[model samples]
Target: MMAFYFSRLVEIFPFFLRGLWMTTKVAFCSLIICTLIGFILGMLRSSNIVFLKRLIGTYVAFARGTPFVVQIFIVFFIFPEWGLQLEAFPAALLAMAIMGSAFICEIVAGGINAVHNGQWEAASSSGLTKLQQLRLVIIPQAMKVIVPPLVGQYVLLIKDTSVVSVIGVMELTRVGWVTVVRIPEGLMVFALVGILYFSISYPLILLSNYLERRMAI
Candidate 1:
């Protein structure tokens, strides 16, 4: 039975590949959008401006406090009542961006805050504007603290793509679930799903570890 199921899976491999491609596209696009928004919000959160800090803090808090599945439901189901319509893919990406940016925002904020006050003073003493100080001196230093965890966060985000399958995005997890119904081999179907996810995430795991070691030294 296992051999038969395996053969069945192999025959349908291209379908799985299509699902994997969809997952990759969503993850990659979300990562880019999250990184940009997170960095900007992080910088603002780390700044002396009280209002901006509080505003972004509220957003991060709300995002972190909620369950991702709930967030996805809200985006997909609730938004249309508010006259904002979105297809499955865009809704999934929006959910990913919102959730990912909040976490990444915290990471970036923590990294910036980790840099010493002395570094800031030194840059200011050199007559560099605040923007120049962050650009030339601070962010460069913060990246060392940021990169390792950022990579790890990326792995989490990739795995989180599975949750987006709940919205009918036809991603890898959804594909596996659909296949299991047809193949009647839950273990085999999902095991292939696990392998595919690992194939995508394991390299990032290694890179995260490498960055940790490199940054520590």
Candidate 2:
């Protein structure tokens, strides 16, 4: 029976490939959006402007505190009540962007905060404008602290793509669920799902480790 199911899976391999492609598309687009938004919010969170700092902090706290699945539900189901209609794929991407940016924001904020006070002082004393200080001095130094965890967060983001399946986006995990119903082989179906996820995430895991080591040196 297992052999027969395995053959069936092989025959439908292209279906899995399609799901993988969808997952890749979501992950890539969301990561890019997250990184940009996160860096901006992070810089704001790290700023001396009290109102901006507090406001961004509240947003980050809310985003980080809630479960991502709940967030997805809100985006998919609730927003329409407020007159924002979204399809499943866009909602999934929106959820990913919202959740991922909160995490990446903290990573960037922490990296910025980790830089010594003296560095900021030096930049200021050199007559660099606030933007120039960040652009020319602070952020470059902060990247060493940021890159490792940012890569790791990317792995988490990739896995979180699975959760978006709840909204019917037909990514890899959704494909696995649909296949299992037909194949009646949970282990085989999900094992392939796991392998696909690993294939996507493992290189990122390696890159994170490499960055950690290199940054530590």
Q: Best TM-score goes to which candidate?
A: 2
In model 2, the clashing pairs are none
In model 1, the clashing pairs are none
Per-residue lDDT of 1-217 in model 2, one digit per residue for the tens? 9999999999999999999999999999999999999999999999999999999989998899999999999998899999999999999999999999999999999999999999999999999999999999999999999999999999999999999999999999999999999999999999999999999999999999999999998
- Candidate 1 lDDT over residue span 1-217, tens digit each: 8898889999999999999999999999999999999999999999999999999999999999999999999999999999989999999999999999999999999999999999999999999999999999999999999999999999999999999999999999999989988999998888899999999999999999999999999
TM-score of each model, paired residue for residue = 0.97, 0.98
Model 1: residue 13 alpha-carbon error in angstroms = 0.8
Span of ten consecutive residues with least summed lDDT in model 1: 1-10
Off by over 4 Å in 2: none
